[model samples]
Target: MCCLISAGGLNLIQLQKWNQAAVAKLCWDLAHKEDKLWIKWIHTYYIKDQQLGDCVIPQQASWMTKKILASRYIMLQSYLPSPQHQSMIRTFYLQLIGDLPRVQWKCLKFGNKARPKACFVMWLCLQQRLLTADRLLKWDIEASPTCVMCQQDPESHEHLFVTCTVAKTLWAKVLRWSNNQLCIATTWNEFVQWGISSAKGKAQQAQLFKMVFAECTYALWTERNQRLFESTSRHVDQLAKDLAVICTVRVPPGLQTLIHSFQF
Candidate 1:
């Protein structure tokens, strides 16, 4: 069973079927020794009353075996075993639906879900896997944990994504380029809510904003990694230009034509 799970190749449906079979095997082992007793009782009660002869005994016994097998199947299902497998199932569902405020509009292109990378980062934030800039820099055993971007005390998902100066700059550029009005959000929850509720015209500009948001997020993480691992720094213009190049590559042909018309 461990080997099957550790193979890392089977999909969810395959894993579920494998677990069901395992459970059934365990149930059958527990009940196998009682098979004779069950057959005896069936013979004494079901066959004698019905006046069935010896030939019918085999048929009746086969029927009883099937009944007992089904009963064991149900028992196995109800056992509440495999907690680790259950947790994996739940995590899969959570990632599929996403969390908090719900940015379904932006995720529509991904088959009504966020991109895998975006979903993974969001899950990490939900699980509190990220550390503050000071901790990242000082290897600080302890600190107020302010964000590197804004340096306002105590970093968190909200601060890093929406409230930081770097994030604000990115948002401003998006608004300016798309020629749209946007309300700044101070918290992660609020940003997600705004993403869901904000007016998104079915036009090139609206589509551009979607690309901009995804590209900026990818670029921001790239910059963060560079700073952490390579001891390198980047100007905001450079980051934005990188993001623009990525967005240009991903934009639909119609939108790409519009973007190309710009002097920048």
Candidate 2:
């Protein structure tokens, strides 16, 4: 039988020598009959080149063979689970399934006037990964299921961030103070969509709106944590003033003039 020396200097035997019955027996011996479909799939897609002379190994990959080899190459490259490999799989899955809805990811996390920590917290809130009381309860952590800000509704991403009386009141004061006529949203997703759609016109206005929105989200969360851990609470008006102060400190010089115009 002919043998080819590959680039790695390994003598490779051609496909003709593979014992089909031995492979089938190996598959059967490894698992039950119900689990052998994968073995069948591998055999079906991995057909050997019948045109090649017996025992003659192919020396190089052609365009037709590149994809076939690349798939196996990628699987071999990541023997252990890792962030890079997980990201590659996530990208592949997203490409296969197509894009999600616009409202699913409308929150801006970067390129705005919000503080970096505030942006990150707001981003997590948008992603529904923020440790809201509901999320904590779901994780079996010790937390009250009721909203800390309002104490009138079940605590959740939506209720705490948008629909709570405290949140709604704070938003009303903020919108009126900023000279924005946009409507308040009742859910986290809708809030994100509103934040994206309401800030129209010049880039400066949009950026200032985002900065204010992020600061509000961050301040609300911090206030909630303070209430939870320190047994302290701030009134809705006070929380709104805190949010305004944060926005004033973070806004650009161009926006500082308008921010100065608003009374806290």
Candidate 3:
């Protein structure tokens, strides 16, 4: 199962990449460790004194053996790693994984203090993959096209998080509580960029902002769900207060001290 993950917040091994790495290890062992029993067996049985790529996977081979042999083509594509060298396997692994570009909001989405659920929501928001009214209607699903909070514009990631009246009020209160009263974000892009540009380096304000930003996104989404599914809603002021309480608990001691000093 593919679990939700990010570039920074929580580190986890991608199973697919890890499997590729394991296969690369097998290739390395075949080339270097002739003394190994498994390698000896492969040479005696399937390989029969032939190159790895020349030998095809036998139909009757064990599942694990087939798995290892299956990687022969892939292993041959890259320059083979050095014999018995640690960097050899790592080089192959990196080659197999390839270099993928990161999203602009990666650090913010996976910050150390950011809650994983909130970070996941932020990820959806950044990808514009949330089930907003625009997406639902496009899918031919019968749903109101208007923003539930303001009921004035089409519900979308942009409106729900930035331009909705409830959202703007909540953001205002939150920014004030975070001692960033002058900061304003009218568009979704601005909201994301604010988090990225403001949180430059490991400044205390930056860390606190990342923590606060995560909590705000999570709380706003929760409020939207409650209003839609439960027919209940929190006032913007309450959301701001609740965000403060959550951040107080989530941030490290240094950030807690920084937040507590802000005038409510």
Candidate 4:
């Protein structure tokens, strides 16, 4: 292959940083997949046993070819894949995508057994980026400047998710059902601080707290949409009952006791 030597991205690979090393190993294996005819052609005509990560791209290489080879940014020099652990690839992938600042609610976000849709809403709630009325009005959209849940204050993330009468009632019911002491506190910021301080435990109640938190956000947001767009609404009690069924279905058997005991 016509190529130039690399500029020393090669370094000793560490098991701790397997995300980089694994990519290098996969690039090393590009020529070995015998089932693919096109890949074999590329291997024979373009690569020809040249070190894949550090080699220069041919001027005639297609844009797609150059793009494909750009995996070298993550590839460690001289790294080779091992059969030592089957989970290494998955571990590497999680590490690759999870390179974010660690937060306490991460377990609630990912490890809590909430539904995917609920978790997505919970993410938006955490970022306070939900399209509440205040945000819509700021964007010059013709939206009510009052809270939909209470109609007493501007509908912002803090009011809608935290202090509104509807939200306070729903979270009180949900938290009380979980038999958590946290039911005493009412506010989104308080709950967020609670997640930061207490949600780190792996206990069943802790998991239940996280699951119901996300579930309640999903329910409240759905209720808000129903009132705003559909011009239909359910009572907060009905929302609680719906969440009871949902929590019963979403939670594990041990946590069902909590959901089953949801009285209001």
> What local distance difference test score does each model get?
0.51, 0.62, 0.75, 0.68
User: Which tens-of-lDDT digit does each residue in 1-264 have in candidate 4?
Assistant: 011111111123344546454653455446345567767876777878787655687778877566556655553423334646545454444434444344445666646678878877887787777898888888999988987777788888878887788988887776766676644446667767866455567777778877888899999999999898898999988888888777788888877775667564
Judging by lDDT, tell me the better candidate of 2 and 3.
Answer: 3
Candidate 3 lDDT over residue span 200-242, tens digit each: 5688887877777777888888888888889998888888888
| Residue 215 lDDT (model 3) | 78
**lDDT string, candidate 2, 1-264, tens digits:** 122211111123333322322232333222223356654443344434332112232345344333333343233332334534654443333333334334323435435578878876776677678898888898899989998778789999898878988778888888777777555576667787887675544566677787777888888888889988999988878877777877888787887777788775
Misplaced by over 4 Å in model 1 are 1-14, 17-144, 198-204, 261-264
Structural similarity to truth (TM-score) of each candidate: 0.51, 0.58, 0.79, 0.70
lDDT of 2: 0.62
Q: Assess candidate 4 and give its TM-score to the true structure.
A: 0.70
Q: Give the TM-score of candidate 2.
A: 0.58
User: Highest TM-score, which number?
Assistant: 3
Instruction: List ranges where model 2 is wrong by over 4 Å.
Output: 1-107, 200-202
Steric clashes per prediction: 0, 0, 1, 0
Rank candidates by lDDT, best first. Answer: 3, 4, 2, 1
**Tens-digit lDDT string for candidate 1 (176-235):** 554546647877777765654442656666566555555555556656667656878788
For every candidate in turn, the CA RMSD to the true structure comes to 11.1, 15.9, 3.9, 9.0
Give the lowest summed-lDDT range of ten residues in model 4. Answer: 1-10
